[model samples]
Target: MTSSIVFDPLLPWPLLAVLAVIAALGVLLALWRGLPGWLLRALAAVVLVGALAQPSFQTEDRAPLSDIVLMLVDQSASQTLADRATDTEDAAQALAARIVARPNTELRRVDIGDGEDNTGTLAMAALNAALAEEPRARVAGIFMVSDGRVHDMLQAPDLPAPLHLLHTGRQGDWDRRLIVKSAPAFAILGEPVTLILRVEDDGAAPGDTLSEMRISIDGDTPQSFDVPIGEDIEIPVTLPHGGLNVIQFTLPEAAGELTDRNNTALVQINGVRDRLRVLLVSGEPHAGGRTWRNLLKSDSSVDLVHFTILRPPEKQDGVPVTELSLIAFPTRELFLEKIEDFDLIIFDRYKRRGILPAIYLDNVRNYVEQGGAVLIAAGPDFASADSIYRSPLSAILPAEPTARVIEEAFRPKVTDLGHRHPVTADLLGQETWGRWMRQIEVDPLEGEVVMTGVDDKPLLILDRVGEGRVAMMASDHAWLWSRGFEGGGPQLELLRRLAHWMMKEPELEEEALWAEPTGQTMRIIRRTLGDSVGQVTVTRPDGTEDQVQLEEVAPGRFEAVYEGPEIGLYRLAEGDQSAVVGLGPASPKEFEETIATGDALQPLIDSKRGGVVALQDGLPSIREVRDGRPAAGRGWLGITPRDAFETLDVTKTPLLPAWLVLLLASAMIVGAWLREGRS
Candidate 1:
């Protein structure tokens, strides 16, 4: 297919040039001297020099290679929202057929799925990878069939040829998105936290701008109200308890919209206590009193106010303030004034010694009824006539003390109920537990008897008042375990669980339902006191429901891993308890802007002389255009023909033979000699 002249010199070109110069000089000298046959001699010298310069006619056999055309099909989640999926499929088929029909062209079709981990549409990244795999010289064109909501636009590759985008979705398509502009991951419990949110419609949305919004916590019944569209609204939330709290906001889906996935947004905020204020009242100095104080003081988040009544009201001897080493307890400020501010109050070995009046004790009783926690660590005095149970505080006490104390050594035992209770479940290996030497006899009035001592008497009882919690431990010898008695049991851990449970920690709740999102799967957890748990109903963002069964991993803990097939908020319900958790991001990158537009891909397309044409109008025909020229027009998309080829074989033929040169030179010499003889 290609031909050219090639040379192979019999002698070096430098030596040939010298011989030609000498021959030309000889001819010039003879002509000047009027010598015969000077022209013949010069002709003979030229013929010999030309024969030394070997030249051949070269020809090559070549094969033409087809130009490669790449088609990027975007099948991400957004593309399936409405009729965009149909548009994309049909357009891709049409374009592939058209490209294949062209002369000497090959088609490479690549499908783009949802980006990993909800990264949205990776159209550009996928296209760049496809380009890297093919030969750049042979790549004639690229096309994208998508909704145009690409997230990785910065990864667009340099155009080997023009890029043409056949957009899906119609101009009248619209979507409503609920955006949580700002939400903190941590919030203080019992304090109002503000969340900034906005609900707006993209594309064309009809009806009033004011839309109804529903807000729910922990998947409870949502509260609805009208919120103005296109405005950031501040929603104040006061968390009911501590630990992970899930709040979900939703906008009711209308008749015609892309999806309701973006219509709902979920925000998880961990509720933590700003400060745990504890009131510790000790009746007298004892060996175990320091254990409670040390435990509470060790936590930096706890504010401990400890008071030891060293001198009772009966101490009216001549020991005045000068001799006494104690100051009066702030009973009025603690029990009456600031009792509600404290999260927990401990009555350790405390008895009615007249230090705190009946009025103060009554106030403490009222405090427990109004969402406060009370823990009574009993000592020998708890069974005496001066026991605090004799005061008005006995109204909320879970047990009533009998005037008897068991002083025999016996290891404390966890009751059947305690094995199912979060506070004492899985606390220790019961066989290795140490013994407590003393325990007060008490009759369970109203509460759960979680622990027992010798003769199966109540050692620990827990109960809930109106909106608060109360706990009673019948023995003061728990410090023996802390001191490593008989291979010390889980004393610290038990006490910690008790304190947190009394403070209403969500993880320490006896009954709870929540879901933790883990990479496209939700670890649905259900904590209950019941023997068996039921199936959990999962409600997807698309209003589809799935029943998932839970497996018991521990005595009271049950869980199941549910694979999340879609992105957005998922509601889980097991019996009376319901929970809401966002498996993937509630506002996914794909659905962030559901309405199709070419703004993101336009710049990349323009850089390569490409154009974005909506498929809703029509599937454009394919054509071939020159490189660097406009490749997109009103009714067609263009690809450039690279005109590239590969050579197979080569051949060469000499222009002149050695015998011909010799014959021509001999004739000229004979003619010159004849002419000279005639002269």
Candidate 2:
């Protein structure tokens, strides 16, 4: 309980001030006039004013509130290095015991770990959250047990009391980490790209040292080379394939190092072809010949080599050969000499001609079987005896043509498999395709049918032979859609995808598995030609396996989202196709500086008149001090006593009762009047 003098005035303060001033003036006049009983009148006026003031003795039923000391404990990934975790736990327990032993003091323990993402230690954020919960007046001080490697210092809250840090690690600790200073996201295939990297040592670095740096691509055998420490080295790397390339750079571990987590770094880059070399051979001139030429020529990335047979060798024209404006086809050079150099080979409405002998056709078939791509666009001539199928190339062709050619207006339709195949899947406006006037009747012998013509006959077929791929289009009137003969469709899109698929682009693969990472979450995707897919088994960097089921989002596509527990490389496999993806970084931010120091948090502690002590020395004793006094010493941390109380009830007793004041005032007046009348 507590007691104090408080006032409950009977009237407004302004009015009371005016009345007091008037009474003072009246007393002065009475004194000047030598008035009898003037003392009594002054006393009566004092008693009346005191009663109106209504001063009272107020008593409160009080309850003392315990002071709160916020303790922020860091348990982030970095704290796990060496004996930091054990040291922190020991110090925290000792501090808790001391605080609990103090009278009217409570400990608010806030355990801080890794951040929401891969961000390093967030000790300041945890401190702010803990402070927000408790009353500011009751917060005595803040105590932190950490390595002092805080990432968010700008969010530090204004201190209500002294802030002290108990540093966790020893002074002689050291670590070495690899840093990729600069790298490109994409590089042209078969071309050397430069990468800048550095090997850095933090805390107690050796004076002079040479380290062996090992490099690898896609889990290949590592190649090692000696590099000087504490300097940037430029490395020239050439990608092996045309897709996502994973390159890893690592340095050998050093003696007495804190950790090897930051020794290796991985960089992912996409490999793209500088130019697409396409060999286009047309057997004869047709209305759609210019369409193919125009499409290939429009793309700046394509290098088109077009040849048209305007005159057959057997045709007897009236004009001499010298006058004819036609050059001899380069079949020998293209089919044998530089066949593998071309990315794709296209035969537009081609037929068996004397220009290309049987030996040249056999070489073309061999080219397609040895990791080369071929696309055949057939016309009515495919059904005749002059068809290229009569040559040795028929062995690899996806379809065999019948002797009949259908010349009717029929709209092209996508087959059920086409809806799932990446090359034809989700083609714009596929349901409403323009009509084609001519198509060669064919039976698929070795590939999947993606598009059909009249009476559900195969119009487009795709297949993989040996190590190469092949695509065949049976209709010649596909250009009619580009001419807007009826409502135009995605003719250009369909042809572009078909060409890319033939080039074995990874995105157009029939069966593929890959993952995309956003922060710590990964979206695993599976593309297949089959209706149903099995569960994907994931292998983490630590060699742990997890089986995840996939949900069908489209006809041939399945996907699942997974949040990784740690940061590192992850391998995914479904059936025969497998992919590897890296999440976060090869080295997380927390491990960048494993050796702990108080340099990061010293300024924050100094701002609040606090000190930092290492737990290696010993845990400090807790002490109570005034708010503005020094709160930290060589071996002690301090907390300010709030002396806070909560009031349960209040009782008021007026100093001067109304009845007593009235009786005293009346007697004083009567005496003043009687004395003045006698004088």
Candidate 3:
């Protein structure tokens, strides 16, 4: 229990001050008058004033809350290396047990994990969170168990009590990690691109020499060369193909190294084409030919080779064929000799008019089989008696022409499958887009129907033949959609997506696995036309598979997030789909090739005037040292003692009761005044 005297004045302090001055003046006037009645009046006035000031003795029961000790455990990717995790766990358990055994101390254990993507170990952030949950007065001290590679040092909160770090690793540990100082996402194929690579040796003495580093491309033979201790060197690498190229770089570990996980780094560079070669063969010349030519020629990257058969087998209007147009179409050069050189071939309103021989059609079929793309824009001629389906090229086509054409105006709508396919999906959702008016009707078989026309027949079909892809747009009147006959559409975007898809762009693949690393969290996305995908298997750098089920939020998009356990190249595979993504850096800031040394954390340790005691040397005993005293002694871990005291008893005695003082002073003055008056 505690007690104190509290005053409750009847008047405000300003008013009381005025009253005190007036009473003092009246007493002075009575004393100067030397009258007995005046003295009695003064005493009566003082008694009245004392009664107005209210005062009370307050007492209450109280209990003391226990002091809290924050225990911050680093469980980041670095802590998981080798026996460091075990060390941290054991230290935390021991500290918690000891704190619980104390008489008036409570333990708050906070586990600090890796940051969101791979930012690093956010030790200070965890400390701040733990501090926010507890009372500052109750905080006895803070104990941190970590490798001491904290990234958010600026965010560290003001400690109410002493802070201590129980370092986790041993001294004299060394590490070698591969660091890619600079790398580009997209590089032109066949051109040399410089990649900045740094082979660093951490925890080693300044004079220590680093061994050779190996650089390789796609698991090919590695080139070995020596690198300096702490400098970046430029290495030129050329991509072999116009696709994704995976490059791996590694450094050999020295003796007494902590880990080899950070010794290797993988980079994925997308290769871009120097030129997009396109072959456009027209069976008949019309206004649409100008449209096709303008579209292909508009792109600076596109190299279009357009050929039109103005003189058909039935037309004999030429005075002399050589004089009309002397330049002959190099059918063999395009179809047979350099078929693979062209990325895509478009057949617009073409029929079996014997312009391209059967041998050239055979070559085109072989081109489609060998990863070449082909697009057939059919008109009424596709359904006529002279349809190209009767030619040798029909064998490789996805659908057979019915030889019946419906030339009616109808709105083209996307199919259910098309709503999820990359090429047509979300094309109509844009506010600036318009609708297509006329579409040709055609029955599709053994292919994906992307668009439907009159009578719900397929207007557009896409199919994969062998390694190549083929798309058939049943109508040449698609240009009418662009001309806004009824309403305009996103004609240019549709064509661009179609062309890129045919070229097998990675982002346009029907089934793909893409992962983006922010911090420690990997935002994994799986795209497929299938209803639901199986569990996604993620293989870490250590070759451990973590399988997680995906949740389908949309028709074709499936997503899930995995908190990366470590910082390295993580391979994610969903069914047959696989992608390699880097988590954090080539080496984590904490581990960075894990041979433990006192280098990176030396500044922090020295700032606190702390010493590094190796666990391998001996387990040190804890001691309560005085504040400002040396916190380390021989074979002992010194803990500074705080001068803390508990309230035993509290009491407040008023100088004197206002009533008692008033009565005593009045009686003395009245007796003195009466005696003086009698004298």
Candidate 4:
């Protein structure tokens, strides 16, 4: 309980002040004139002034609130390194017991986990959130039990009290981290991609010397070499394929390092073709020939080299060949000299034309075997004696000509195998496709028949020979789809998929395993032509293995979601297919700097007059300290007691009564007058 005198003036403060001034002036005048009993007159004036300015004795009823101590415990990924987890939990429990035991003190404990999206430990965010839940006046101290590697120091809130850190880990603890200083999201195929990387040793590093760096591309055998620590190393790599490439770098863990998590880094660099060079060999000027030309010309990245045999050797035109307006075919230059330069070769209604000799056709066969792509769009000539099957390419052709061409209109239908093949799988709006006027009949020898026409005859065949791919379309009416005959189908998408699949794009692989990350959970996807895919064996970054059973979501498509406990590379494998995907950022903020220290946060700690005590020494005791003073010592952490209170009720009593004031003023005036008259 507290009591004090408060005044309620009858008039404004300025008016009351003027009245008091006048009364004091009268007393002074009486004294200056040598009036008898001047002190009694001054007393009466003072009593009247006091009565006009009403004063009351005010008292309050208050109950003291307990001082609040906020303790934030770090449960981020970095805390799981070494013995920091044990140290943090033990210190938090100890601090909680001590704060609860203290008289007139409350403990506000908050356990913070890894920040969303591998943002690392947001200690300041956690601390501020915890503070906001408690009364600011009652908050007396703040404590952080962590490894002191806070990522959000700039987010520190206005400190209502001192902040202390119970640092985890040891003084001699060290860590070796692989830093990808620079990496490109996409690199041109066949060009050397330069990567700026650095390997660093932090804290009490073991012997400042070189460390071995291992590099692996697309799950290949790792190649290693000794690289100097704390120095940038530029690694130039030429990608093997034109698709997404997974490149990983690792530094072998040292004996006393903090963690191996930072020792490895995964980077996914997409290998893009600088220019898609396509060789189009047309047999004659045909209506469907421009469809292939138009499709290839649509993409600016594709360089189309169209060679048409407009003038065959058997032409008997009297006009001189040199005076012809059409551009002469450079058969030798394209078929012999620069044939290997093209990524794909398209034969649109092409036959066994005399323009390309048997040797050039043989070279095309060899080209397909040596990682090249070929797409044959057959016309009516394919069912004749002059078919490409009669050339040296017959050895690699997936089907043989039956010398029969069906002229009846028929709608193209995907085979059962085509529904699983990446090239034709899930073709959007395939049911709305129009009919083609003709399809050449053929007998399948090898490869998979993905599409059929009337009488279930093979219309499309896709196969692999050596390291290359071949696609044979038995019909030349695909242009009908592009022209929107009846209702157009997904011609563009189908063409794109077919071209990319022939180019051996990883995404179009019929049998493959891959994953994509959504936050910390990995969506594992398996694509195959088989009925079922076995459980995928996932090898975590920590070298732990887990068998994940996938549920089939669509035909030949299996998927399963795995919530990763750590943010790093997870290698998934199903049978002969395997892939590596990073569940989070390659270098997560959690493991960037795993050493336990407060150097980065010294300014924040100093502003709060806090101290950093290592758990390696011992868990310190709690002590009370005055505000605006240092609150930490070698053996203890100090918390100031706020001594806050709330007023339940307030009572006010008048200090002076009106009757008493009137009586006192009259007596003083009478005495002063009597004294003056007697004198």
What are the lDDT figures for the candidates, one per model?
A: 0.87, 0.88, 0.74, 0.88
Which pairs of residues have clashing backbones in candidate 4? Answer: none
Q: What C-alpha lDDT does candidate 4 achieve relative to the native structure?
A: 0.88
Q: In candidate 4, what residue range of length 10 has the lowest lDDT sum?
A: 563-572
Q: Write the per-residue lDDT of candidate 1 for residues 70-156, one digit (tens) a residue.
A: 999999988888787887898899888988888899999999998887788888888888988988999999998988889998787
* Candidate 2 global lDDT: 0.88
Please identify model 1 stretches exceeding 4 Å from their true place: 1-61, 204-212, 216-229, 240-246, 252-261, 322-325, 399-416, 428-446, 451-458, 480-489, 518-520, 537-546, 563-576, 582-584, 645-679
Cα lDDT tens digits, model 4, 1-679, are 9999999989898988999999999999999999988999999988988898999999999998999999988888889988788888988898899889999988888998888866788888888888888889999998988888888888988899988988897988888899999999999999999999998888898776799989888778999999998889999999887666888888887887888888888888888889989998889988788888898899898899998887887886799867889888887888789989999999988888687889999999999999999999999989888999899888888999899989999989989999989888888666779899999999998899999998999999999988898989999899999999999777788888898788777789999888887766889999999999899999987899999999999888999999887766778888999887777788988899988888877788888698999988988898999998899988998998899999999999987789889899999999999999999
What is the Cα-based TM-score of model 3? 0.68
Best by TM-score: 4
- Give TM per candidate: 0.80, 0.82, 0.68, 0.86
Misplaced by over 4 Å in model 3 are 1-69, 80-116, 205-210, 214-226, 240-246, 272-342, 345-374, 380-406, 409-472, 483-494, 507-586, 593-658, 661-679
Clashing pairs in 2: none
lDDT tens digits, residues 554-615, model 3? Answer: 66888888998865667788788887676665555655545544455555545534455555
Total backbone clashes of model 2?
A: 0
Per-residue error for 150 in candidate 4, Å, reads 0.8
**Pairs in steric clash, model 1:** none
lDDT of 2 by residue, 136-250 (tens): 9999999999998999898988899899999898878888888899999999998999999988888887754778899988767899999878899999999998788888888
